[model samples]
Target: MSDERSLATDRRGAAAHPQLCAGRRARLAEAMARLGGGVAVLPTAPERQRNSDNDHPFRHCSHFHYLTGFDEPQAWLLLEADGRSTLLCREKNLEREIWDGHRVGPAAAPAALGVHEAHPVDALDKIATDKLANAPAVWFPFGVHEGLQARIDGWLATLRERERLGVQPPQAQRDLTPVLAEMRLLKDEHELGTMRRAARISAQAHARAMRFSAAHFRSTQGRGLPEYMIEAELLHEFRRHGAQSPAYGSIVAAGANACVLHYAAGDAELRPGELCLIDAGCELDGYASDITRTFPADGSFSAAQRELYDVVLAAQEAAIAATRPGARKQDAHWAAVRVLAQGMLDSGLLNRDKVGDVESVIDSGAYRAFYMHGTGHWLGRDVHDVGEYLSLDEAPVEQPDGMGGRVVKRPSRVLQPGMVVTIEPGLYVRPAEGVPERFWHIGIRIEDDAVITDNGCELISRDVPVAPREIEALMRG
Candidate 1:
């Protein structure tokens, strides 16, 4: 299908329900009003050429989409504090439409998108300059789009040129990122519904990949199964379930490759006994769902693989337990760390004689060798969604510096209802002198998307079996 047709199909429902975007814009405008009124300019992401006339898939800016719900390129949204919205979009070109499929031309934009006004993209310079004149503040996302600051400067320069004509440029320039980030951090009913669907699709994809790995390994006697093959299965399942795209590049690491975090799906053979770590997700509508599962290739985990998998699973459980309203975000990481540290000590991954006890191991950073990255990150529109991790209003508190010392740092943002996070705890055991050989080259990460609730956290991506026996049972089928 043509790109424009596909985009239209994807957003048909959203276009019909204009209140979602309208409500978000109202909230942002109210925020601007609180800051004493201003004009906000936001541009959608620009399309980039991949190589030699071919272009990468176009994705609208999350912030822009959050406000406008428009997906086309060469578009900009102008929001005024008085609740007026103006959209500058590409003009309808019959010639271009022949190749691109459809354009939500300026004539239909107001009614189609529920914006107050619409104009062709070329009018942004003149319109923005006019809007900025006599404004108390001009708000735009700082340091996001390349050349955005320069463009704003150019607009301000134009306004300054007309200073003698009683044209007054904005006196204050504020970043819109923080405002939008705080807004996007919480998922509304619409966003939550979309995310739940995404999580279900991603869970199914992971399950499909697991079963394919076991079935292929057995059918070919462990000869032809490759990481990309499993990745293909994931992509297939994602699209099969109507997901627009993978949330990020799928990580389909096999055996030792799993030790390297962020390993892209490659041609590594999926050996029978070694574990496969599939860290992947799917993007449905504009929301994202992230999930990771580590499973054995031949259906049953090896003794060592199962041991580490159990530890990572337990750590994820602890993290999930801590993901509730009113709990600080870092509380989940600390909970996961405590479980992982204890598991490492008991499993001999960390020598108890050398690292002392779990607390000592944690304080001394001895657990860094096996478990490196944090337990989780915010999950939403973007995979590593835009939201401040630290609390803005809270005072700094003294916490362990990980070196048997104390340091003052601002606490993480407190989890609240409607917040979405990924509870991913991983252990990558590389061959080291004191590390057990049995645990070497084992990398296990169990992740699930959790939605913070008033009662507790809801694991949205649990359709796939997490237990060893359950996974074995699924693969056996």
Candidate 2:
């Protein structure tokens, strides 16, 4: 691992950077105060059962983890308007600790996580009820956690019972998601550092999978190279480079499987002339890095594959050029669409006689048959990270709906420094009437993580090759 010092320490045992979490909590507290003073409760994700007597791997909630750097299950955080924070976590049971693993019990949570106070998990109802009494509002993420609304209602109900004693329940309930979403839209220095490391690791994994596929194909004369085997290679590289886990399910699509979009790694064999698309990324220190690269099963691409790959690569390049400070978020998507719409006509995927010009193709949405999905999305703690796509402060305006109609909509957000996004453009061709025969069963996507800078966006996931020649040279090595 190059730049090992830049990587965040594994946070499995304890909060790796309590000060950063403390700062985030303070910001939330101030935001709540600005919103008329309230108490906010956020619960971490619960452990889920996979099968009889078996449990799935536990992943902490992104919002909760953002506020408190704690990764334990069955934990909750309370942030008050006065910059006070409380943590409710599992109690220390030596036997359970032996069965599970080390837990930062309530006794140590205050100091370990930089919270003002801590209590056992069982005391949530009592403590929350007390905190909510006479508060103007209670804030929580609506439509997020199941059973959370009922839990807050229970607290309010408890306070209602003592109405005669001058105890008052919260007068209103507010959604905390929008407030936090705005705060998390921009990456701070600490988050940017961690995300950069994750991008590096995921890029290395993609390169490793490429080399593994090419070597296996050459040695066995295009035999015994399954998609799952290549997926395993990616996983191996991610773990070896200190990633906690894959950001999402790995997509190792071979040949026609690539057209399925969300295809999981399966037993599909890597044929010599076919393309294999691997869309995988790693999650390090809670931040995600998503990268996708399509390469030939052998060391070289077929003529049809190379042509389509170049088209998709050119689309991604156009998208990348439009991802910079002051540019609207939709600018990149439209830029890519313009390039792809033209490619579709030039390649005979869409007949110019039928689709007319590129503008007509875009206006009629005729290009969606081959190129669908947006050019990119916000990338951070979650793969498709939480952040509003539309500009909230601006008034809605009527715009052309691409079908010779008008619709009212808010404009997409304007790109700004410290924001992170993914620039992914793809063309998936399935055999159909009027489509080029040579382009059948061919799919190509080029994705990279981009960090918005003062001048332009920086491509963080470019450690792997994107050009046809570079990819061929890399696989040959």
Candidate 3:
């Protein structure tokens, strides 16, 4: 949390750097005014080195940068609703810059970030305490940092027993979710453009993986290839295509491994003839793009493979078609689930696939056995970008029906313009060892990033292979 311990060098030549900073400042200003002038503490997440000698690269907090736009660690962004933003950063040191790289310490932070004030990070605690003191309300993410909360408490306690009679804390200490989430709903042009580039790079990575599947594809039959290898290939491609890094962990699940939604370790290999589901995305300039594709390891699906893959792909396509303004985020999921449940019902896998049963599963999400995980996630900034998915009326949007009940349990955030999210509806059938002959090791998932528009949505990764023949062609080409 200190520049003394920071691994970052100074900023290099990049026009995007300043623009990124200014854009976030705009969002912060809007939020600060809404909450009544108060100080908001935005902390930068520090870098965790890969090892003692090899430090990991620092990735700025999307939300924090969305406001302050400072790229240094141990930095704190102070936004005073009075209409001023200041960045507190590490002071520059010749020794460190020569050792690591150039730094945007206190001196350079103002010009670099377009802030009204700049100070050394060392002054953060004192400055924050002074600014937060006596304010009617203090705005800080309590659970996000216990120390900050305790500081607020101490500041309040000091005020209550005030040697200074006029200073006092405000009555309400609310979570800062309302304005922050609301501001992130509509993507500014800059955000949308960055996300578009990320989607484009993500598409290239998927295509590269498809074309070079053999060099790294898994093929052990019952067992699969190491999930990590597929992740490596994608990472290689992402960097080659100018992606700063993966937006999140690359989920490289092979066969039954895919059954575990959000699989962590990428150790499993693609079993020969089995499916390898790659749920991965990369960040281009802090904008995120998520894409998933499941394909056979042998570059061809069996009759059953095609059956299940086609079902998921079909459901995804249908869902994609239904995304539009006025449509809810849940709408697409509802449509995809019904279609997938019907596919399972027709295949005799679910044993029930009628209007009533499908509707029930759509309502209860019983088909999760094969089609687990949400249809998609918000895509931008953080991989699961910010924004409300539900409408003000609280009606569910494109969310698939037949999911578990509980409104909060479901992300009813309405779909709106300038939102980018992935539309990935999948089906995974993992038969217990020697349990059922009807089901066996199989997991198929197809995912794509879609940009929500005013009337409809645009498929950004249309270049990625989704159709069976196209995948085959890409692999064979």
Count of backbone clashes for each model? Answer: 0, 0, 49
- Give the lDDT of residue 210 in candidate 1: 88
For model 2, residues 1-477, the per-residue Cα lDDT tens digits are 444433444433226788888999999999889889989999999899999989998999999999999998999998899989999999999999999999899999988999999999999999999988898899999999999999998899999999999999989999999999988989998888788889988998999999998889888876767888999999998887788899999999999999999999999787888899999999987999999999998879999988888889999999999999999999999999999999999899999998899989998888889987889999999999999999988999887565546789998889999999999999999999988899999999999999999999999999999999999999999
Judged by TM-score, which candidate is best?
2
lDDT of 3 at 440: 73
Alpha-carbon lDDT of model 1: 0.90
Of candidate 1, the 10-residue stretch with the lowest lDDT total is 3-12
lDDT by residue (tens digit), candidate 3, 114-153: 7888888888766776776766566766576436677667
Candidate 1: where is the Cα deviation over 4 Å?
1-13, 403-405
* Structural similarity to truth (TM-score) of each candidate: 0.96, 0.97, 0.86
Give the poorly placed runs of model 3, Cα more than 4 Å off: 1-20, 23-27, 47-56, 157-165, 215-225, 265-267, 353-357, 392-411, 432-439
- Give the Å error, residue 308, model 2: 1.4
**Once model 2 is optimally superposed onto the true structure by TM-score, how far is the C-alpha of residue 377 displaced, in angstroms?**
0.6
